[model samples]
Target: MTRSLIIAAKCIAFTCLLLAVVGVSLWSASRRVPKFYEHALTQQLPADELAEAADQLEQEVLDLQSEIQSQETWEVIFTSEQINAWLAADLEQKFPQLLPTGVSEPRVAIEDGLAKVACRYTSPKFSTVFSLELDSFLTETTNEFAIRIAKARAGALPVPLKRFFDQITARAEEANLSVLWTQQEDSPVALVKLPTNLDDVRSDVVIEVIEIEEGQIRIAGRVVPGVELQSMPQQPRFADASQPR
Candidate 1:
């Protein structure tokens, strides 16, 4: 009986040791910053250059707004650098409440048809770089856009989709936007229905293209005379500014 007890204790000790090793490995992974995120953080811009970039982004937005109001075809393109600048400086200064609690220092990288968005996430227990890989396209359904979230991670570790889905839903609710959640090839997709009519201007906005290419995103669409398009609020325009520190 003593021999059996000794063997049982030995087995228990081995199990405990194995669990400890696994726990430590996962902890380490959660703390390791991703290469893309690290590079984004290091590429800083001067204050003057940041302001110039922010101005350029605002100009593009204004132009798009004018075209939409005129009921004319319009196309706008934005570079990754210009967007990063605006996010770093103008967004926090002017719209500090835009981001959720415990999230800050947001940045983006556009490459190979993917837009990588990363931000610092802090919690009571830890702080890490949280990122999402996304791609947007017009769906087959009329006036619908699909924003596919390909992957989400915390530092170097993959994060569960539920947390992100909850956050997205909450944000959409706050903005008074309706989001339909679906899955494509195991990835969660958020379907946003674009308003066909601008109530204030009595026009229809049809978005034909949302293409993401290396280092840039291009949006092309047309507006036509119709009922008011003011059923939904217009998307916020991004302006160039400084890099997030």
Candidate 2:
């Protein structure tokens, strides 16, 4: 073979090898599961315990609703375990349509003022654990709060911000909640405004505080005289895994 032809052939082979390595690296990274998600999957709770957690969450929601109706000050706290139990045991079985398509097995971890929400995402191309690191706090506006998306990942690989924004927008629309998009320190933040009143309840609900701690979240608010409010959505009971499908 001519020298120039031999050099050209070597260049092509090198390019092919480089592409292969890059492809493999990306595939490996995509399959890497976050430690928090892995732990959530491995830890098994007894049926009775799971039921208790779900019940606690349900009762809290009901209490909050009752307080709103009575125009009283209210505070509700939820633990990570309680929320996870509700998500796993009740959400999918009862309100399957609540979550967008291709998302399942949702779980959350809250610590150091940040909440990590992870879920299993399945697409035709691949399946992976998708997670979002979020920081939520009350903004200056009344009943308004910001959930900043600090980072989003599919497994260990960083995912595009647009993907999460799209999902957030869809969810807000589905729930009839108002969400405004803005930037905070170069990170995307979703500003959520809680309606003062529900269609069925004419009392104004004013949210005053949102506090997050290790493994727990507390929200305190008050209800006063006002016009119409959008009724909050109802929650369904969760079926235990041991139960018949």
Q: Largest TM-score belongs to which candidate?
A: 2
Backbone atom clashes (below 3 Å) for every candidate: 13, 6
Model 2 residue runs over 4 Å out of place are 163-167, 199-202, 227-245
Lowest-sum lDDT 10-residue window in model 1? 236-245
lDDT tens readout by residue for model 2, 96-118: 78877899899998887889899
Residues 144-238 of candidate 1: C-alpha lDDT, one tens digit per residue: 78787898888778887765566776778777666677766677777776667655555677888999999999999888654434443354221
- Residue 131 lDDT, candidate 1, scale 0-100: 88
- Candidate 1, overall lDDT? 0.79
